[model samples]
Target chain A: MTQQDRAHATREAILHAAAQEFDRLGYERTSLTAVLARAGLTKGAFYFHFPSKEAVADALVERQTELWAQVRESWRLRGVDPLSALHGMFAESADRMAADVVLRAGVRLNADREVGYPGVPSTHLMWEKLVATYVIEAAERGDLRPGVDPEAVARTLCSAALGSRLISSATTECADFPSRIREVLGHVLPCITAPAWELSGSQSASEPA
Target chain B: MTQQDRAHATREAILHAAAQEFDRLGYERTSLTAVLARAGLTKGAFYFHFPSKEAVADALVERQTELWAQVRESWRLRGVDPLSALHGMFAESADRMAADVVLRAGVRLNADREVGYPGVPSTHLMWEKLVATYVIEAAERGDLRPGVDPEAVARTLCSAALGSRLISSATTECADFPSRIREVLGHVLPCITAPAWELSGSQSASEPA
Candidate 1:
């Protein structure tokens, strides 16, 4: 392998090691020495790549945010109908909660403000904005209920989606969690559906569409 | 005064110290030494009151749960109708969230499981039972829709309530959070209203008594 490839591999190794140790022991208790130990590298090597513990945390946050955005964009590019797209998004999210350690740590950081990680709050805001944009697009296309403010509905939906993430993260034995989230999304979607009943012929359905 | 009073004072001091430290640095990072220092006691005195960090967290959880139960029972006893009682409950919870640090920490724990305390799974289950009890009572009184399953509806409501809690926790400037919570609850209450929306009379009345 080239020198560049080896350097990239070392960087990825440090990130992976940091995420696992931070998740296992948390941010403050996790020392630079432990991270170097876990990565099988010296402190000098660690300092060569990252400046501080906070920088490592910031990098992880950025990676997780990119991961979420990529997931959303990939779904959007497929042009799935809005509601199904939402379900797919949350289902994929819960699936991550069930599997990814770095993502889980990122979620835990989202929950506690004391553990400051860069881009965490912005990640949340960005997720909400994405949900709102799609819902508004669906509403414009006559796929959503009539007379509903897509932004408000999007906020509620985003809230529910985030809450689902929290629930999935809180348990280890939540084996049926992804299905439960999909089911709950099914129940909540109707509330935001236009016409409120008939899902199309109810009161709001009369709006020009 | 009495020996009981001295013991109680010491216990209260420890809890207060622990709560502050926990809130300041979270459950994992807050050291027992800091808690003892904050409480103006030695490690022996701290251990006399609580055995471990986990024990302190458990005590806080127990206390919060008992307080919320009383909060719910008080709402029922005040003769508020089921719907208004439900609204009032959410509003009251928002008020509590605004006022208390410990309760805020508990809400954070409930939302992001990997942070704050590790007992978030049990906390989520406790909330499920809490909401389930109210939904069932409301159903029996002809307050909920006929087709709704209390358990399922309870889970859904808990999800939304937690969703609202999440928004509230994440934002410091949303002054109308309580009203927004009520609005979401208002929309959801109809979907689960008793006798489940008859075709003719659904438009005129605000959810039946």
Candidate 2:
């Protein structure tokens, strides 16, 4: 590898170790020495890439943002219906949370205010904005019922997702996260979708007024 | 006052002080010495009632359960419709969380699993059970739409409330908790309530399917 490529690999290794340490012990209890040991790198090497623990956390948050943007772009390229695309994106994100320790750690750190990573967008707000964008498009296409406020439905969906994930993480350690997300969408979609466009049998299509 | 009454008062004072301390600094950072100073009690007096910090946290969770029960009973006595009663109870609870230090502290502690209070009922499960009871009654009375599942709706509502509260607490320090709750209920009620029994204009009543 070239000198620059080796530097990039070292930075990625440090981030991977930091994510595992943060996920296992939370931001408050995770130790720099332990992270360095887990990364199999000397303290000098660790500091060569990231100056501090908070800097690592900020980088993780930024990485999550980039990851989500890529997920959205991939879904957009598939050219699916807007609501279906929203559901697919959320389900895909939940699957990633179930499998990716780095994503889960980044989410946890972003939620923790004491971590002091200011200017990092909250996961909830980011999800809300994404959902709202899709809901607005769906509404323009008459997929949502009349008078359904896109912003309100989007906000509720985001909150339900957040709440379900939090409970699942606490109770089952997120082993059931994707199913919980399915349940949340199942409950919420019936309230917002137009009767003719209702997607799942779990929801009864609303009758005409 | 009798000696026993004075002792009870002192115990209450110590708990109140501890809740404030824990809320401000979280479970890991709170100092018992600061709690004693806030409560204006000697360390001997503080230890007389509660053996340790974990004991205080356990007591706080228990207290929150009792408080919620009383709120539910008071709403039941008022003889309102089940869905409206649930909304009232949640709104009242949010108001209390905004104005009451002990209740807010109890909620924060309950969410933090590292506090290690075994067998303590999670605030989410407790709310879900309470919401389910009301939803079941509403369904039996035909207030909910056909095919609506009380348990599922209740779980979603509870989760949404939790997510909204978490977001509110993080962004606005929960100063906007009640309104956020109002938004959650407004979005959720439309999906669950029967068309003929829809509650308010804030929610677009689901058209008959």
Top candidate when judged by DockQ against the true structure: 2
Worst 10 residues of 1 chain B by lDDT: B200-209
Q: What does candidate 2's lDDT look like per residue over A121-187, in tens digits?
A: 5566766787899999999999998988898888888888888877766665566677777767777
Estimate the lDDT of model 1.
0.64
Q: How far in Å is the alpha carbon of B48 misplaced in model 1?
A: 16
Candidate 2: where is the Cα deviation over 4 Å?
A1-21, A32-56, A79-82, A114-146, A196-209, B1-17, B33-52, B76-85, B114-130, B133-146, B197-209
Lowest summed lDDT over 10 consecutive residues: which window, candidate 2 chain B? B200-209
Residues B1-209, candidate 1, lDDT per residue (tens digit)? 79999989999888878776665455666788888888899888888888898788777767777777887787778775555566667667766665666666554533334422345445666666777777778777787766767777656666666666656544542234555565556556656675443322111122221
Model 1 per-residue lDDT at B91: 65
The residue-by-residue lDDT of candidate 2 on B150-192, one tens digit each, is 9888878888888887776666566777777877787778778
Quote the lDDT for A109 in model 2.
Answer: 75
Error of 1 at A81 (Å): 3.6
Q: What ranges in model 1 sit over 4 Å off? A: A1-7, A24-26, A33-45, A107-123, A173-177, A195-209, B1-66, B78-87, B99-121, B136-152, B192-209
- lDDT score of residue B200 within candidate 1: 26
RMSD of each: 7.7, 6.8
Error of 1 at B129 (Å): 2.5
> Which window of 10 residues has the lowest lDDT sum in candidate 1 chain A?
A200-209
